[model samples]
Target: MHPFARSLVTFAAATAAAIALHAGEAAARTPAKPTIAFVHGAFADASGFGEVTSRLQDRGYTVVSPANPLRGPASDAAYVASALQPVKGPIVLVAHSYGGAVATPAAKLVGNVKALVYLNALALDAGESNFGIIERFPNRFGEALRTRPFPLPDGTEGTDFFVDPARFREFFAADVPARAVARMASAQRAVSLSAVQEPAGEPTWKTIPSWYLIGRQDEVISPAAQRFMAKRAGSRTVEINSSHASYISQPDRVTELILRAAR
Candidate 1:
């Protein structure tokens, strides 16, 4: 064979081998789509994650948005645990607002949880409740809504706590349209005060690799408090310019974060 021909043949063989190795590595590194369990925050049910869940399902992910009892963490955690029991694969637990509190104990109940995605969610330390965490910070929303009487039998009070159609647009769902916000507020459930006051026993974020979505314009939970919680949890933070109901305001960004964790 000619020397030039031999050199060309050698180069071709080397390139083929490199391509084969790269393909193998790529196949090996590809991760399965994790079962994503979404937990909604105070005053909201599973429906709050409708848009986000639909987006995730479109991408071929197994999505579970469980309806929390709006009870204290212990009871709500039990509900979350039961919901997770049917999942047959790895899980990426995603929580928003008060749902973050529920995710703590629920994540512990599930053995296959791979990561946590918090959407302006609570990140409680040991023996800390949502109220306890906020107590340390300045609470404009709490102060404003403190005077408004809770219509529910159980005296829980907050702007986003009841989900009035008029107030929802102004406080939680300002970015969303009137009809959607009206529907959301009409269907909203009242979270128990016990849930807010009850402290988390063991925070799951402490052990899991966590990611946080910070709602920069959040009024319900202070953006400052969100930052503090995210930092303390050692989370990877992404900011969205939205109100307390950021998942509704920016479903795409929220879905993207969840998908990142699923991978």
Candidate 2:
């Protein structure tokens, strides 16, 4: 064979090999099924993300809803960090309500997180808390809840707590099944007044690619407030016509948003 022709053939073989290797690396980096870590808001446990989790899992995602202590953001973030420690691939951290406060700092602790999904979730600015935002705009729901408080066994004020079954269904999760709403009401946790009062240091949404699900019918946290937070976070927003518990009321939409972030 001519020397120049032989060299050309060798060059072509090398180029093909490089292309194949690059393709393999790209596939390896493309996460088989991105892991999704869900953080629930106040008055609920990890179980609150049941519907969301089921939907993600059905679509081939490894979902983790860490049992946050509900103590405060710092502790909750620590708890979530522990849950995130073992994850192997890319992650999409989904936060609902107070869960956003927890996941904000928690996402910083982990390296695998690719994006964040906020479901009508809180998005605090520097040195701001949930209480500060709400205080700026007093709403009927907060006023009504404040009228009838649930004093904790420790004697601390629990004004940020949830209401009973009938109210929970009507206001929070009217679209969810009665039995599920009852279970949620029964499992409701008394969020500390300090939790809302404490300021978030640095919100993660500022640096991360974030997607927000705004509940148009939210009463617990006003729909207006959700929009405000979403704007400040510079998040890609998707509005759902559901209550604050959109994960329960509009699970499919919530699931779709999460999967979008995972992509």
Candidate 3:
């Protein structure tokens, strides 16, 4: 081969090898991301996580937002665990509001949930019921709440709890856009009263590394209660100036915290 041509070929080979080596190093440094599973709370569904889910999906995350059975804590957790069982890999389980009460137990059942990310979510301790913990802190949540009785499958009666749509914006999402809050209120799902009274099982936050995002302006769940729970569970906590609708109003912050737990 001509001397110049031979030199050019040698340079090309070196460049190719260098590029391959860099790619290998990059791959080695980046670990495979865990699946992110979300559990929605009462008065809402999985679609409430639209912005956060979209952001995570855009970043190549495998996301699962399962419908939480609003019957009660134990039942809800069992359903969530079963839904995520088919996902093969580690999971960073995230929950909001009442869903937090469900995620802890579900994570324990799923067994591969590496971290718990709470977004203004409940972090119930063993033997603590939803209403039990909330009563520990003073809040105006009760003012917006409404309840009704429904006939159960066994022919007995069950009570369903809901936020009065007229007052939803004031207590649930004061900071969110009025239009958005209206939509949320209209589509809200009711949680059985038994759910609030049922005691939580052993908490998964006890064993897993957990992250908590507390909303200072949350009228539903008091920020003081959030701090108390996060501190007790030894979670890495960040407080934001948001309402109970923190995930909806501050999707970026919410997603950042989840990513931190995920990484």
Give each model's clash number: 0, 0, 0
When 1 and 3 are scored with lDDT, the better candidate is: 3
Pick the lDDT winner.
3
lDDT of 3 by residue, 85-191 (tens): 99988899999999999999999889999999998888999999889888888788898999999999999999999999999999999999999999999999999
Looking at model 3, which ten-residue stretch has the lowest summed lDDT? 132-141
Once fitted onto the true fold, the runs of candidate 1 whose alpha carbons sit more than 4 angstroms away are: 1-31, 143-165
CA RMSD of each candidate after superposition: 6.9, 5.3, 2.9
| TM-score against native, each model | 0.82, 0.83, 0.90
Q: Please write out the lDDT profile of model 2 over residues 92-177, one tens digit for every residue.
A: 99998888988998988887788999997888888888888787755666542422355667996555555654577776676778
**Candidate order by TM-score, highest to lowest?**
3, 2, 1
lDDT string, candidate 1, 1-263, tens digits: 99999999999999999999999999778877789899898767788888998998998998888888877888899989898999987999999998899897899998789899989888888899988877887666653332223454476553324555556667776788888888888787777666788878877888888999999888777888999999999998899899888888799999998878776
Residue pairs in collision within model 1 = none
- On TM-score, the candidate that comes out on top is 3
In candidate 1 the C-alpha lDDT for residue 3 amounts to 100
- Model 2 lDDT, full chain set: 0.82
**lDDT rank, highest first?**
3, 1, 2
